[model samples]
Target: MWDMNFRRISGLLRRVDRLDHIDRLDAASHSAHEGGEGFSARHHRGVFELLPGTGLTLPRHAGVLRFGMSEREAQWAVATLADVRGTWVCRAGWAFTACYEGLELLAYGDCVDLGVSGFTAVHLHRRGPRLTEPSAVPVVLQDIDLFGYPANEVLAAVEPNLHPTVRLTPPPSPADHLSAVSLSAG
Candidate 1:
């Protein structure tokens, strides 16, 4: 786990370094033009501002979901309703998709790095605000909110976090099966 975090940090540093080099190059080129508007420090700062997003470590905040359920507790509150669906909620501008079945947390996740692809990983992680506190690299969620955000915002927050629902297709109708049998007989 430590190695994984180290690798993530190292990758972000490399990206920041690369952006710095690019900004330097851009400034140099603009400087070469005598009368042209060279990239000012202010402008450079603004452009480089986007560079930090690549290193964003999104925090998974815990709060009542879209339906008002708090995650501050370690365990789910209701354990009887075995299979109720889950939902996403937001607070402090952060989104938390929580799965609570009858007051128990089936799962919760925050969509951070969507492009990250690797082997299946399952583990416990310290979910807190430190992840999004202005950095210079993108960190993957080691594992997998209710602010009444608009649909678009909600989708943006949770889309990356959701895995496609896995459900078996309903069995073919008995009538269809019988019809196939009759056809085969004919």
Candidate 2:
């Protein structure tokens, strides 16, 4: 299952890079009016690319599932891609909401393409007039792997709807059986 999912992620990342290239071209040709808001009104859209394993963290057992870019990147993407003058907020699953244009676009994740090395690409965008000083959205990036049965089951009782964090029993091995017999006879 892991292998299959890994492959799928890999393929998706390639497609993302290609699409970003196309988006860059589109931004260059676009001529959109900047809305009179604090947000920058540029014709270019920014593409945030995630490298595989980049979001992984150990103590929490959850990786950096999402990222809210630096102020510079955010402004760049919004101006280039979004036509209206508005502030863009990246919501869950890479979805962005532009307050001015009222536009929502879903950005997909591509960690698998990054492979073990992980991904690194410029989130393309065009410079636009600043509506207000660009500010980054405060995002509570959660670890996707730390949720569900594997993490929760071990911490609590197994329920029909809830998965356990730990495996209920370890698989039997020769050493385990031998120890059991020795203890029983003793």
Candidate 3:
């Protein structure tokens, strides 16, 4: 199951790089104004890009944050981008949420399994879904604007490009809206 999801994510990465692969996304929805608010109006604080192996870049920050970073390093990374809202510790490792206004980042570290005592997962999300409102941060998965485009459009474009390994767990309907995206190594 895990391998399949990973492959699916890999497939998504490939499809996203293809130019204008999803027409609906290119249509009327691309505009922050037409769709609701353009990315410019959302007051985006930074742009984050996908990194190999469940990793992501932090704009204006020195290094990329990927799975296997130490808890301290992860916390420092998030702190540099936004305020650390809260943190939690468990038997396996630790987790925390950082926020830059409405944009939020969640990261988790693992002390066991996968043979690492470091971060294993990272996620980005809006404080809440406002349908037409733009996101505080834009998460670009390949070239697709995970938050800029409508949820339905993103899903539609992604579903078809999926490698047989991954499937949308419940298969989103035309109504689904994208609220969050995650990268994980475990």
Candidate 4:
């Protein structure tokens, strides 16, 4: 069992190093700028300034992508803003992730654990990229800068009462900072 767990973790670790796929991401970014087929021009140049209660709801949408939408719809929603990293299966469900400069968007589908289908959940991460730099896209939640502001400050600003429905997972350690600002499909 330990060996299996180790292997699974190893595979996950390998996937985390996406620097080698820079060309693919670059191509996607270029096409988005050129307004290539199926890619629409993003508003505010793809900087996602999210409103917590409106867009970042646990039972609803994450930005423009809504819960219960198909994987293709989710892809289309973020096509101009990110590079889709393809799909993978895990214990919780099947998921596809997309990458941005400093953010990562993960959408889940066909979740056996939850006995649900379609895109059930979407997560937005501030620490998604393994690179050393901060996110290129500015992600703001309720006027608080998710990437630019200090983690503790951001946390304090988005206290639980602010949006009782949204799930805010703080970093394990203070040094680690804010890793993700995510909401589940309630």
What TM-score would you give candidate 2 relative to the actual structure? 0.18
TM-score of every prediction relative to native = 0.19, 0.18, 0.63, 0.57
lDDT of 1 at 56: 13
What digit string (tens of lDDT, one per residue) describes model 4 on residues 66-165? 5667777777676655667777767545677877665677767767677766666667787543323235554556644455434565566567555654
Top of the candidates by TM-score: 3
Writing each residue's lDDT as its tens digit, candidate 1 over 26-79 gives 777878866566664323332111001121111222211222223332113222
RMSD of 3: 10.1
Q: Write the per-residue lDDT of candidate 2 for residues 63-181, one digit (tens) a residue.
A: 22223333344334444444423332232222222322221222222233332111111121112322121111101112111111121221232224222211122113311100000
Between candidates 1 and 4, which one is better according to lDDT?
Answer: 4
**Where does model 2 exceed 4 Å of error?**
1-14, 31-44, 56-186
Query: Candidate 3: which stretches are off by over 4 Å?
Result: 1-44, 52-54, 89-91, 111-115, 162-176
lDDT by candidate, in order shown: 0.26, 0.25, 0.59, 0.54
Candidate 4, clashing residue pairs? 102-135
Worst window of 10 by summed lDDT in candidate 2: 177-186
The C-alpha local distance difference test score for the whole of candidate 2 amounts to 0.25
Q: Indicate the worst ten consecutive residues by lDDT in candidate 1.
A: 177-186
RMSD value for candidate 2: 21.4
